[model samples]
Target: MTEQDVREVLNGRRAQAARNDGAILDAARTVFLAEPDAPIGAVARAAGVGISALYRRYPSKEALLATLCLDGLRQFVTIAESAREVPDPWEAFVEFLRGIVDADVHSLTVHLAGRFTPTPEHRDLAVRAGALAAEILHRAQQAGVVRNDVEITDLPMIYEQLAAIRLGDATRLRELRRRYLDVHLAGLRTAATSYGAMTGSAPTRAEAGARWNRTT
Candidate 1:
């Protein structure tokens, strides 16, 4: 083949491969969200691509899952980073928590993060997101908007408890989460200090995982 012809052919192949990769990742996200243990073949079918093509893009199901998890982590980091821009610290903190729960309600990655050991990249991204969340929490506490006793770690458990409720209807579930979220937000305020003694200890990661897994 002529040099120009060969270059054109290579470019076309690269474009096609990129498209296939995108489709496979999109399909994997949808399939895994519905069933975390879904097979590679199901993802291939969902993506409308051949199994060989999917395998070419992602050698294994785990690899595909890692990509999905990484993407979700990036999105979470974005939300937390954006929260920092809000003028009010308390509002920023509340919105950050809201973003996490809303994303968790729609995507499986956040839930998976709780269930499985994170990859190094996933862990790093999560830590970055957590740092941003911690900053927001600290700002709120310093402002005396949020209760002094509340720790950053408490936020995840609150989200977990709120997300654990599953109404069969989508509309009802959305409303329920929103209503309970408002209640939880209100309780987090400093003025809501009428409650009795608080527990000093929080659940370990393993304990939290076990509790959530039981509910699932």
Candidate 2:
């Protein structure tokens, strides 16, 4: 083939590969979030890609799960960072919470945590995300907008609780989560406007980490 023709073919192949990768990751998120125990074949079917093609990109199901969780962590970090830029402290906190809930990254934490071993990259991202989240929380608390009783550690459980609400219809499920999230957010306001003092201790960092640590 001519050099120009060869170059065109190579470029086409690269574009196709990028598209396939995007499809596979999107499918994995939808399939795994809907059914955490789903087999790799399900993801392949959902992605409209061959099983061999999926395996070529992700050698094992564990690897794919890790990739999905890593993506979720990246999204978490992005949301928190964006919220930190909001001028209003309370708005920043609300934006962070709402963005997280809408992103539904917590669903991965709830359904897929411990399914795959975390890598060093995962730990680093998790630390960054935690720090950003803490900064948002502390800023709101200092502004006397958020209740002081709420701890940074309380957020994981709160998100997980919202993530646990499920329905066959994604739209309905999301609306329900938002409804409950609104109620939860109201309760998270300053004590004068809150229901009462937050009861029970927040989950410790170690306790929260236990969820992500591979059991095996």
Candidate 3:
């Protein structure tokens, strides 16, 4: 083959690999979220890729879980950073909450938390996401957009609650999440007099971190 033809072939192969990788990751999230113990073969079938191809990329289920958790953290950080840039505090807070609901990172945490060991990189990303989220929450509170009773630590639980809505098909689930989120958002904006003050304490950072298996 001519050098140009060989280069074209290599480029095509790379593009196909990228496409396969995206499919595998997306399928992994859907399958694992539904059934955390589902076999890796299920992910392959869901992605419409061969089992060998999935294994070639992920090596093991643990590897796939780690990648999903890490990617979720990256998504959280990206959303928070973008939301923080919005000119309006309330709008920024709403954007951040909506993004979290869509990303559904907490659902991954609910299902996959004790299944794999986290590396130092994972810890760093978690800390960074936490810090960015805290900044966003603080901004909203300072502007009186969010209730003072809300705490930074409350966010994990909020996301977890939203993630628990697993009924219905994809479109239906999306609609339900948004519907419930709007209700929750209104509550966050002001305390209901009948509800009184937010009782009990938010989950401590330690309590949240305790769920994950950080050690190898």
Candidate 4:
């Protein structure tokens, strides 16, 4: 290769190392959110980086707060992806709703979202996901299955509420989950069920394997 190309490659590696800063921040979210009182050294260890490196990147605890705000946008993509339909559009919305409600399992993700001022890139990703959800919600509304009043943005807000409830008390979490499902099932329109047979079956391991590339 030309000397210029070699220099470019060397510079790219340096740039990559600088960009790696965000990964450590992401890891920091997992620790800080789980235990806000945890020390910086602990967060550094949790992130698998040296304490000096962590301090060098984030001089103070307060600096990390901004990154947490950006995480909400990232978390919602998983919500949107889960909401997407495979064989049928309606079932996709239901699954998407379920994914959001079940986000109790992703506490770190939720913590990142507690404050929402996502970076521009993250915000754009969120906008794309929201558009997809709006289409699905609109279709469901047209079919008279989903609540007509439920706006697209409401999905994220509602999911946050459910996450809050889910995280609050272990004793109530199970009952709350069951009751939530029961309410969802009760609200289903008779016509919503008509498409059930058309949709056929849940994704199996083989079908999942075939569809893996398509899904990502």
Which candidate tops TM-score?
2
lDDT of 3 by residue, 1-216 (tens): 999999999999999999999999999998998898899999999999999988889999999999999999999999999999999999999999999998788899888998899988899999999999999999988997788888899988888899999889888988999999998898888554347788899888888888896433
Root-mean-square deviation (CA) per prediction: 4.0, 1.5, 1.9, 12.3
TM per candidate: 0.78, 0.94, 0.92, 0.55
- Which residue pairs clash within candidate 1? none
Q: Which run of 10 residues does model 2 get worst, by summed lDDT? A: 191-200
Better of 1 and 3 by lDDT: 3
Model 1's lDDT to the true fold? 0.77
lDDT of 1 by residue, 7-78 (tens): 999999999999988898888877877777678899999999999998887888767767777887788788
Which wins on TM-score, candidate 1 or candidate 2?
A: 2
Residue 115 displacement (Å), model 2: 0.8
Ranking by TM-score: 2, 3, 1, 4
lDDT of predicted model 3: 0.90
Model 4 lDDT, full chain set? 0.59
Q: 40 in model 2: Cα distance from truth in Å?
A: 1.1
Clashes of each: 0, 0, 0, 1
State the lDDT of candidate 2 residue by residue for 1-216, as single tens digits. Answer: 999999999999999999999999999998998888899999999999999999999999999999999999999999999999999999999999989998889999988998999999999999999999999999999999998988999988889899888875878988998899898888898964545676789988888899888864
The collision pairs in model 2 are none
